[model samples]
Target: MTILPDFRYIRPANVDEAVAALAGKPGAAIIAGATDLLPNLRRGLGEPSVLIDVSAVPALALVEETADGLRIGAGVKLAELALHPVVQRDFPVIVEGALAVAGPTHRAAATVGGNLCQDTRCHFYNQSEWWRSGNEYCLKYEGDRCHVAPKTARCFATYRGDLAPALMVLGAEAEVAGPKGRRKLPLAELFQDDGAAHLKLAADEVLVAVTVPNSAKGLVGSYAKIRIRDAIDFPLVGVAAALKRDGDKIGQIRVAITGSNPCPLPISTDGLEGQPWNEATARSLADRLNKTAKFQTTTTVGMRYRRRVLLASARRLVDDLWEKAV
Candidate 1:
C-alpha cells in the first residue's frame, strides 16, 4: 500500500498567522480541503516537510458582496458554492463549473481555492509510483525530460480545472496573503503556461478569496464541457462564455477554454462585439475556434477528438447564450 510521508501539521488561527507560519518554511505546503493534496502525497508526487491547514480559518469561509464585487472566500466548499442561491441566481456560470467538479461527496469536502489551485494533470504523471517505475520519470516529477514531448524542454501536463475558464470569462480576481503581505491580481494572472509550475503563487502564499465584478451580474454566461463520464472524470475540453448585450447587438464578449493547453486560453473577441448573435455568426466563430484550439496528448482522450469537441462546444455555448438573451 502507498503510504504518506511523515510531516508536521499546523493550523493557524487567521490569515496573518497563516502567512507567518509559512515564513522561512520553504518545505511547508498549504492544505484547505486535502481532496487533491492527499492523493498526490500518497503517490509520492510531493514530499513537503510541513502542512499548514487553513480549512478552519473563518475569514476564508465567507461569501458576501463588497464594494469591489462578489467576494467568495477560498475556503467555501464546492458543494456550498454550487447550491448557494446567490451563486445560482447571479453567477450561474460559476455554479455550473462548481457542480461539474468530481462527485457530490468530493464537492462537500473540496474548496473553491483548492479547485483553482489544483495541479496540472497528465496521463503519465498521475499514475501510481509503482506504475511510473516501469518507465523514466517525467519533468513534472523528478525526471530530466518530459515523456509527452521528449524533445521539448518543458512539461506539457494539461490544466483540467472546470472553474478556471468560468471565472476567467467573468473577469475574476484572486486575493492572496503571504509573508510579503496581501495582494490582489487578475484571476487569469495566477496561472502560468508551464505545467510543472502551473500556479504562479509562491510556496509561502495562500489564496484567500476570489472577487467578481458587479458588471458581470447582468451578463449572459454559459459553461460547458466534454468528459468521459458525468461524475469524477476530468473535463476533456471545457468552454465558458460571458456576453454583455447593448439592446440587440453584442456589447462585449469573452470566451475562455481549458483542458486543451497548459493554462486556460482566452479567445480574442475583438471582432465579435457589435455583431448580432445568430447561427451564421456562431458558425463563423466556431470555425475560427476549430483552427485556433491547440491540443496536447496529455490525456487518454485523443487530441483530434478534443479538437472536435472544442469547436462543437464553442458553437453550442454561443447558441446557448443567444437563446438565453432573447
Candidate 2:
C-alpha cells in the first residue's frame, strides 16, 4: 500500500472554529466528506500539513425550507438529498442531478458543498504523483506549459461537477463562512471561468449552504447528462436547462453546461426570453452557441466526440421538455 502523508487533523465543531482554524494556514486543506481529497493524498498528488475537518459542524449539515426559498445546508449528503421528497416534488432538477451523480456508494459519503466546489480534473492531472511528474507537470500544476495545449498560455483542464450546472439553472445561491464572517452570493458568482484557478472562493472560507429560489408561477426545469455508463461515471458533457413559462410562452430561461469547460458555460438564450418553448427556437439558439464552446481532450472522450454529443444532448433536452408539457 502507498503510505499516506503525515498530517495534523483538526475537527471543528462549528463554522467559527473551522474558519478560525483556517485563518492564516495557507497549507491547511478543508475536509468535508474527503471523497475527493483523500484519494489525491493517497496518490501523493496533494499533501497538506493540517487537515481541518468540517464534517462535525451541525449547522453546516442542517437544511430547512424558508419563506423565500429552501436553505440547503452544505454538508447534506448527496444520497440523503436525492431521496428527500421535498427535493423530488419542488426541485426535480436538483433531485435528478443528485441521483445521476457519481454513485450510491459515493453519494452516501460525498456532500453537496464538496460536489459544487470539487477540484478540476484532467487526463494528465489525475494520476499517481510519480506518473504525472514523469510526464512533466501540466498547466494546472506548477508546470511550464499545458500537455493538452502546448501553445496556449492558460490551462485547458475541465470542471466536471454535476450539481453546479443544475443549481445555476435554478438560480441557487451559496452561503460561505470565512474568517471575515458569513455571507451569501449567487451560486454562479462562485465560479471563475479560468481553468487554472476555477473559483474565486477564499481558501479560508467553508461553503456553508446552497439555497434555491422559489418561483412557482410557471416552473418547468430539466437536467440531462451524457456519460459513458448507466451509473458510477462522471458526465462527459452535462446540460441543465431551466425555463419558466407564462401560459405557453417562456418567461425566463437558464442554459448551463458542465464537463465542457473550467466553469459552467452559460448558454446565451436572451432571445428566447419571451418565446414559446418550440423546437425551432431552442435549436436556433443552440446552433449559434454550440460551436463556440471549446471542448478540450482532457475528458473521458475526444474533443470531436464530446462536442458532437453536446449538441445532441441540447436537442434532447428541448424535446424532453416539450414531451412533458404535453
Candidate 3:
C-alpha cells in the first residue's frame, strides 16, 4: 500500500461543528470510517487539504426507530448494520447486501453512509494510476473517451454500491447537512447518471441519516447480487425487488437495478401495480427488465453477458418473490 499524501486532519465534536468546519474550508473532505476514502487518497484520487472526521458527530452515528421508519445513521458501520436485528428483519435485502460487502474485516471499518454514498467505480478506473495512463485514460479518469461507450459523451462506469438498489426499493430518503442547513431528499434523487459524478452531494455537505419506511403490505423482498468472489468484490449486476401481494394478485411492485449506471436504476413503470401475481406478470417483468437495463462493457464481464445476466437477476428476484407469496 502507498502512503497517503500529506493533509491536515480535523475531528469535530458534533454535526454542527462538522458542518462549520467543512463550510469554513472549501477544499475539506468528510471522513467517517475512512475505509474507502483513505485508500483513494493514498492513490491520489482525492487530494483534500483537510480530512474532517465526522465520527465524533453524535447525530451522524445514531440509529433510531421513529414512528415513521427506521433511521440509519450515516456513520454506522457496515458490520453494525449487518448485525442489527431491525435491519435484518425489516430490510432483509439491505442486510443481504451489507453482509456481503467486502469481508468481515473491511465491513468492520466501512460505514453505511460511505457504502451508500460510495464512489462510482469501473474496471479501468479503479486500477493503478500508471495502468490507467497506459490505456490513455478512460472517461472516468484522465482520458477523454468512455471505453465502454466510445461514441457516447457520458461516462459508462458502473455504480457498485450493494445497498443502493435495496434502499431504492425500500423507498429510503437521506438527510444531508450542509452550510446552508439540513435537508432531506429521496435517496434515489441523490445520484446522478454520469459515472464521473456519482453523487449530487456537495463538498461541504455530509449525509446524516437514511430513513427507511415500514410496510410489509403483503410484499416479499429479495436481492440478487453477482460478483467474482463471495465478498470484497463489487457486483457485476444486482437486482432488488419488493412485491406486494393481495391474495394471489400483485398489489404493488418496485424494482431497482444496479451496476448499470453511476447509480442504480429504479424502474418506476406502471402496469406492475395491481397486476395478477401469476406466471404471465413474472414473464412480462423479465422482458421489461431487458428493455430498461442500459449496460456497457465497463467491467470484467462482456457487455452482452452483463445484459443477459441482468435479466436473469431480475427474473430470479421476481420468481423468489412469487414463490414466497405462494
TM-score of each: 0.96, 0.95, 0.93
Model 3's TM-score against the true structure: 0.93
Q: Score candidate 1 by TM-score against the native.
A: 0.96
How high is the lDDT of residue 283 in model 2?
78
Q: For residues 158-258, what per-residue lDDT tens digits would candidate 1 score against the true structure?
A: 99999888988999999999887889999989998888998999988999999999989988898998999987788999999998877788888889988
Q: Which should have the higher lDDT, number 2 or number 3?
A: 2
- Candidate achieving the largest lDDT: 1
List model 3 lDDT by residue over 106-193, tens digit each.
8888888888878888777777667777788788767898887789898877788888888888888889998889899989998988
- In order of listing, the candidates' clash counts read 0, 0, 1
* TM-score-superior candidate, 1 or 3: 1
- Model 1, C-alpha of 162: deviation from truth (Å): 0.9
Model 1 poorest ten-residue lDDT run: 285-294
Winner by TM-score: 1
For the record, the alpha-carbon RMSD of candidate 1 to the native fold, in angstroms, is 1.4
List RMSD in Å for every model shown. Answer: 1.4, 1.7, 1.9
Considering lDDT, where higher is better, how would the candidates rank from best to worst?
1, 2, 3
Q: After superposing candidate 1 on the true structure, give the runs of residues whose Cα lies further than 4 Å from its correct spot.
A: 287-292
